[model samples]
Target chain A: MKTRIFSLAGIAVLLALCIAAPQMLDAYSLGVALQLLSWIALTQSWVTFSGLTGYVSLGHAVFYGLGAYVMALLWQSAPLWEILLGSGFAGALLALVIGYPALRVSGPYFVILTLGLSEFFKYIVIAVEAGLESSGRLIFGAPDPETLYYIMLLLAVVATLLTWGLARSRWGAGLRAIREDETAAETLGVPVTFLKIAAFVISAFIPGVVGAVWVLRTTYFEPMQLFSPTTSFTIVTMAIIGGSDRAPGPIFGAAFIVLLSELLWARAPHVYLVILGVLLVSFVLFVPKGISGQLAWLMRRRRA
Target chain B: MNLKSIALRAATASAAMLLAATAFAVEPVKVGVGIAQTGMFAPAAIPALNAYKMWADDLNASGGLDVAGTKRPVKLIVYDDQSDFTKDAAIYEKLITDDKVDLLLSPYATPAHFAIVGVLERYKFPMMGSTAASVQLKAVKPGNIWFPTSALPDVMGPELVKLMKAQNIKTVAISTLQSPFAQEVEKYLKMALKDSGIKLLSSVEYAPDIRDMTSIVSKMKSEQPDATFSLSFPGDSVLFMKAAREQGLSAPFQFVLVGPSAAFFSKIFGKNLDGIVTMGHWSPYQTKWPKAMPFFEEYSKRYNETPDYLDVALAYMSCEITQAAVAKVGLDHDKLRKEISSATFDTIDGPVKFDGVSNASTPTMFLQNQEGKPQIIWPASDATSTFQKKGPWAN
Candidate 1:
């Protein structure tokens, strides 16, 4: 009861800080905060599906790219809320279409297929844009950064809650069962394919919305840039660094990377990348459970 | 008083004067920019960065940048945007809101430039842009940012057709990179070709990350057109060049849209690079622009490599315009914007005057790699040398 109360209090404080960010922070810090929220939202969504199912995905960028494309297409023509909704729908629809076949495979094959499908979709978008003879797009008169920040904050909160809720649900347990022993879970009467697809679709929705909001920050969209593999790579890196085992892992991970980059990029851009590489290697080799897991272990030890 | 006492008094007085001067030296002007220090666009962006660096060095060497009557040293606040448009925009916002830089410099690439227009508008900051050209730039509201490049795709398209017509070339095959600038140029080129009654044998568009030009070059070879125009960026230009050479697709009037002017291109191709025409408006061989050769020589001497004829020239020219404007009206944003838009500043590319965001003075021109040197080959007035057909590829 004490632990639950403390957790609730911590979440409340975090929510307050996010709400006060636009009022308190300067433009640059607000931009950083927006970036942090975006990563948090994306990583949390990834954790909801990949963390629970043990089916690692390397193509979350596809949903994000699709969302941004939908935003670009419907930018000024539709209302702001409609554009965002349309973007989210585009991502969810794509996820639903790709999930059934994609979830059939497991482990490395699933990872590879997700990546391949992402690339295939990227080329398809490119070809579509080319056929239209539109090379790129720039969004004029995008809402100010402050407005975008609030939207991102909402997404981040919802994503975190969704992950938290799903992690404790019976559905999460069944997914974990599939991760441990798929045949046994199937024999136990778990709807493995349906659960996996649902999780995949749930994971994809937020990233899509996040991508739409992100593009407004730049107001420029090129297919190659929007669908870059680096986005996927960064998402996976954050998940690994943050510890994908818990609901709060993505928050810790996103904050760590964003703050570290903010502190170092201005001073030493290249060195920051090198340090990131070193940290990633160290985490994979030594601290396999990541920051959140390590923290949990420390807490248990203290109680003991 | 003894002679020793008199000498000591004189020395003390001179030392005191020196200290006072040091204390009173004007504060440096903080000019901020976010450029691609790493990632895909680095190869193209580094030249622009070098140009900015060279300009600062030269100004400091000559008693700093002239701010009205007083001379203030320039301190450039540079951030690496990593060739990401969104990151580039964020860096600009940081530079404006956090760093609080006094002046602004443009970032590299068309997309990065387009990304920051909102920030520029929001802050009412004026910047002189370089290395970015597109038809869409004209659509941007004309106050905060001005493009010094005369190589607008719409203009270049018709000019290219005129140049081809001048050389008596008829049938042409075109291949383009599916990038905004490249594709825009391709669109206009096709329109111009159609308008001018030039027969288009074939047209192909390749993805920006395309590596194999085997099929594209083969298709061009099969057509056997009189001219082949590869509207490509640096990386793809190299791919197209290699594929063309290996496949021996020797269209006499071959024009690669970009990448020939970079120092690496010549180093890579050497004699084979000769006779290939590329887009550029500036050259050292143009004696009319007296400052051109000296700027070229100084850049070459400082960097131990040849500057990109198009990007570097435009980058340095932006600095010149910025310096000239600052010298006229101190670092006031409104005054700088007005001066930049209205004033006819003398640049290495000759007199540059912006008429609503685009450089109205500099002519849209092309350059050819003639015997390992970039020579102006179009718009007779700007041509340092006449146009030439492609020679046989080196073995």
Candidate 2:
């Protein structure tokens, strides 16, 4: 009861801070914040499925790319809210279609399948754009930066809260059980396949919404920019580095990586990737459980 | 009226002197360049960046840019975009919002330039593009973005065909990387070739990152065209040339787009480069334009190497355009944009007049390699040397 109250209070303060961020910060700082929020939303959505289910997906960028495309295509015809919702539904539908076939295979096969799926979608989008004789879609008149910032912040907060709630639900336990031992969980009538699909679909929906909002803010993008396999790897790496086992792990991880990227981008742009690689390797070797997991362990030790 | 009055007078005089000094000081005009300094685009972008820096330094040395009646020193703030469109957009935004640069210069490559046009439009910042020359950019119709380089692919294509017709080239083979920019080039070339005396024997498109051009080169060789044009990036241009030589395939006329821009090409091919025609915007040897000699001399003296005149000319022209506009409008962005849209300036490339959408229809010069040096060969008046009828490797 006390822990719940503390969590609620913390969330309230975070919400207030996000609400006031645009007014408080300069445009440069606001842009940085938007980037951080984007990473956070992507990492959290990735962890929602991969964290509890113990299934690492390397193709989540497909859903994000699809969402961006959907938004781009519909922005001129449909209302903004409809475009946002349509992107989310499109992502969920794609997740359901691909996840059923993809999840049949486990381990490295699943990872490869996801990675290949993103590449497949990337080429398809390229072909479609080429056939249409269009370079790419451009949003001529976009909303103000502060409005987009608020939308992205709202998405990030909702994704974080949804992940927190899902982690404590009965469905979450079933997913975790399947992660531990799929055969044993199936023998206990856990409906392992159904649970995995559900997690995957829900995980995909958030990134779709975020991607649409991202396109609205950016006002322009091409297939390669949105659907690159490197983006998938980045999402996975952020989640793992933050400690994928906990809800808050990805949040911490995304913040650390995004801030570091911004700082290194300004100073030593060429070596930013090299520095990130070294840090990732170091985190893997020393803190395998991630920062949050390590902190949790420390608290337990003190209690003992 | 005692010692106190004298002390008060001294204080007032000192404060007045400080105010006078503050009033006379000039604030610098800041120019921002967000370009790809690393990754695949760096080979082209770094040279452009260096050219901009050199131009800024030279202007400052001359006591700065002429703004109205006063001279304000020019300062350049540069950032590396890493050749990614998303990152380029964010960095450009920072340049506008954080750095508050007075003038903007376009990034390197078509895709990066296209991505930032919306931002430039949003901020009402006028940008002069040096490297980007895509016909596709005309589709967006953003009034503030200007292209100061040679004519875009659409115009350059007909010019190329005119040259081919003049040389009595009956058959042509073309190969390009399968990118949007390359596609636009192909589209325009094919359009220009329609109904012309010359026939396109083969048009091959290869992936952007394909290392092996043997198959594509072999396909072109099999066609046995009188002339071959390879539209490609610098690295791929080198690879294709090397492959062509190894395959023992030679055409009487070979036109390349990117290879001649780099000195590395001359070093690699040496005398073998003779008779190969390529497109360029400017050359150090050309003395037609008044600014050409001074620019080439100063750049070579400063960098201690022969500069790529195309890159130097583009960078120098952008600065010259900005300086001219600012001088007319005195730092008012709207009035400055209007001034830029309506004015014609004499640059290193000669008279530049922007059209309705701020695209200058500058002429593209065709040059042929002669004894390891590029000499203008086409458009008789601009020709420093006549076109060679046959290459040394011609069968």
Candidate 3:
């Protein structure tokens, strides 16, 4: 009970800090904070589905790209809230449509299928844009950085709450059971397919919105870039580095990567990715449970 | 000592002190640029980056960036965009808010350029964009950013059709890469071809990451069109050139959209690259632009190789225009912006005046690879050499 109260207070403090960041930080720091919030939202959403279920999705970019596409298409046509809503809806709808068949596969096959599907969708978008003869679209006069930052913070908070709530629920246990042994979980009447699809759909919603906001942030969209495979790769890398098994893991992951990128990119752009690769490899090998997991372990050891 | 000698000594001492004081008073202008220094875009960006470096070096050698008569040395704060738009935007934000650079130069490609338009708009900081051309540039707000390239797809498309018509080309086959710039060019070229009464034999579009052009080349060979247009970027340009050479796909009026003007293309293709028409306006062989050859020679001497005729020329021209504009109005944002918008600054490509975002004075022109040199071959006025039919593949 004491630990639970402490955790809740810690979360509240973190939320307050996030809320104050735009006002307190310099423009560059605020931009970096915005990036941090974006990654936190993305990684948290990924954790909701991929983390709890141990699905290890590598096609997370599809949702992000599709969301951006919807936002790009309806940019000036719709209100900000409506465009964001439409983007989220587009991502959810895509998840629902693809999730059924995709959830049937497991392990490496599922991973490859997700990766391939995103690539297929990327090309399709490319083809559609080419056919329309509107190669890429640019958004003008997007919401100020402060507005985007606040929205992103809301998303990150919501995603964190969703993951934290879900992880502590009965459904969360059932999802973990499926991860441990899918056949056993299905036989035990866990409603495996339904839960998987639901989680997948839930996970896609925020990333879609993140993508919409990101397109606004960049003020330009090219299908190739929006649907880049590296985005998906980075998401998975962050998840693994931060600990994919729990809600708090992604928060640590996002912070670590965003902060490292900030510190390294300006000073040593060429060697930044190389160092990230090394760290990612080290985390996977040594601290497999990630920073959160390591922290939890240390706390438990001290208590014992 | 005599009174005349003493008086002269005093005058010389004060003059030297005044000169030193004047030099000390002017701070170095912190010019910033975020470019693709690494990743896939790096190969294309190197020439532009080199041009920026060379321009700064040249300016420093000639005293400094002449900021309204008080010559301030340029201190370029360059960041590697890593070929990501978000990173590119962040770099720009850092450059503006943190680095507090006085002037801004453009990032490399069309997408990166478009990415930073919002930042430029928000800061109300004006930038001279090079190595970017799209019809969409017109849609951008006219004050903060200006593109100096004459290679707009809308303009180049009709110009290419006109050039082809001059050669009495009746039929054309087009293979375009599925990139924004390439696709836009293809769309315009098709519209122009339709209007020109030119026959469209076949048109194919390939993905950007395509590894082989064997099938695309084979299909083009079967059509046997009078003209073949490979609307490709540098990578695919090399692929198309190699495949066309190997498959012996010959067309008299062969035009490769981008690559042939790049130095690497001539290096890779050698004598075979001759007579291949490509998109570029400024050429060293054009004696009309006095600064062109000296720039070409100096860049070649410095880099130990020929520069990319298209990108390097555009990059240097942007720097020259920026230098000229800064020289007139110093670093005051409003003054500099007004000066850039209204002024007709001399560039290596000749006099450049902006009517909105596009270059008003420089006509969209094409270059043909003639005997190892990229020579202006179109629009008659800018043509250094008469149009030549592409010869058979050397293979």
Candidate 4:
């Protein structure tokens, strides 16, 4: 009871800070904060499936790219709320369609399949755009930085709360059981396929929404930029580096990586990635469970 | 009382002195540039960055830009966009809102520049596109943005078609990377080719990073066109050329858009580039413009290498135009933009006059590679050498 109250209080304080950030900070800081929120949302979405189920996705950027395109295509005609909701639904439908076939395969095969799916989607979009004879960066008028910051912050908060809530529920237990031993969990009548698909769909929806919001902030989208494989690599790396098993781990990981990259990119643009690689490797070697897991382990040790 | 009186007097006197110093000192004009210093666009963007830095250094050395009556040094605030459009937008936003730069220089390529148009328009910062020359930019038509030394594909197409017609070229094969600029070029070239007594035998658009062009070359070879034209980046241009050479495919006339400007092509192709035609905006060999030779000499002296006209000459001319405008208008963005739009400036690339859409009508030179060097070979007055009608492999 005490821990639950503390967590709620901490969340409330964090929410308050995020709400005040746009007003309190300058445009540069707000921009950075918006990116941080985006990464948090993306990392948490990745964690929803990969964290509990141990199904690492390398092509999650497909949903993001698709969501961005949907928003870009509809921005002029539709209301902003409709665009966001539509993109989320689009992502959920895609996830359901792809997940049914993809969930059947496990391990590296599934990872490769997801990667291939993203590449396939990229080429398909390019071909369609070519067919229409439209081949330039699409720019939608962007919302002000403050409004974008709020939307991104709201998405990040909602994604975190959903992940936190789901992690403690019975669904979470089944997923965890599946991750530990899929055949044993199946023998115990866990409805393994349903749980996996559910997690994948939920994960897919959040990134789609985030991507829609990102398109609003960015105001421009090219197929290559939107569907970049680098985005998928960054998202997965953040989730793993943060501690994939815990709900808060991805948030921690995302914040560290985004802030570090942003800070270093301005001063040392060339070797920033190399520096980040070193840090990621060092963290993995020293604390295999990530920051949240290490902290939890330390607390348990102190209690014992 | 005596001690407090002395301290108060000392503080007041120091404040007065500081105010006097501040009043006399000229504030530096801040110029912001977001270029791809790393990543895929680095090969083109880095040279532009170096050229801009050199321009700033030279201006500061000459007692700065003459703004009104006072001389104000330019302070450049540059950031790497890592060749990502989204990052370019964010960095430009920061440059506008936070750094509060007085002027803006465009990112190196069309896509990156296109990405930040909204931000530039929203902030009403006038930008001079130095390296980008896509016709698609005209569709945006932001009044504040200017392209000084670059010509759109539509403008270049008619000239190229006329040149080809003069050469008695009957059939042509065209290929391009599926980028916005390349697409625009291909579209305009086809339109120009219509009813010009020239047949387009084959046109193919390949994916951006396609390594092998053997199939495309073979198809073009089979068509047996009089001429082959490809609009691609440096790497892809080299790939296509290598593939054509390996397949023993040749046309009476062949033109590539990018590779001839760089030393990389000369090093790789050597004598194979002889008689091949390529398009460029400026060349060191063009001595008609008085500033061309001096600019070339200065750049070579500073950089310890021969400068590509696309990277150095065009970027330097952009800075010169900016300096001239700022000098005339004294840092008022609206007045400076008007001055730039309404006036004709004599740059190192010759006369620059913007069309209704603020797109410059710069001349596009078609040069022929002769003994590992390019010489202007078209547009009779600018031609230093005649166009070669046939290549070594021509049947």
Measured against the true structure, the TM-scores of the candidates, in listed sequence, are 0.97, 0.90, 0.98, 0.92
Docking class for candidate 4:
acceptable
Can you write out model 2's per-residue Cα lDDT over A1-304, one digit (the tens) per residue? 7867997899789889989999998777888899889888888898889888888899889989899999988886887888988999999999999999999988888888889887887888776775665556666676667888988898898888778888899988898898899999999999999999999999999889888888776677677778777778888878868888777888888998888888898799879999999989988999988877988899779979
A best-first ranking of the candidates according to their TM-score comes to 3, 1, 4, 2
How does candidate 3 score on lDDT?
A: 0.91
- Interface RMSD, per-candidate values to 1 decimal: 0.9, 2.0, 0.9, 1.7
Residues B31-52, candidate 3: write the lDDT tens digits: 9999988988898898899999
- The residue-level lDDT of candidate 1 at A59 comes to 84
Q: Which portions of model 1 show Cα errors greater than 4 Å?
A: B1-24
Each model's fraction of native contacts: 0.68, 0.30, 0.85, 0.45
Candidate 4 chain B superposition, TM-score: 0.88
lDDT of 3 by residue, A90-183 (tens): 8989999999999999999999999999999999999999989997999998999999999898898899889999999998998999899999
DockQ computed for model 1 against the true two-chain complex using alpha carbons: 0.75
The runs of at least 3 residues in candidate 2 whose Cα sits more than 4 Å from the true structure, single-residue gaps closed, are A302-304, B1-24, B141-143, B271-273, B378-381, B389-395
Q: Candidate 4's error at A211, in angstroms?
A: 2.4
Native-to-model Cα distance after best TM-score fit, residue A303 in candidate 3, in Å: 1.4
> Residue B188 of candidate 2: its Cα lDDT?
82
**Proportion of true inter-chain contacts also present in candidate 4:** 0.45
lDDT of 2 by residue, B215-284 (tens): 8889988899988888877788888887777776678888877767666676677666677787776765
How does residue B271 of candidate 2 score in lDDT? Answer: 66
Shift in Å, residue B166, candidate 2: 1.7
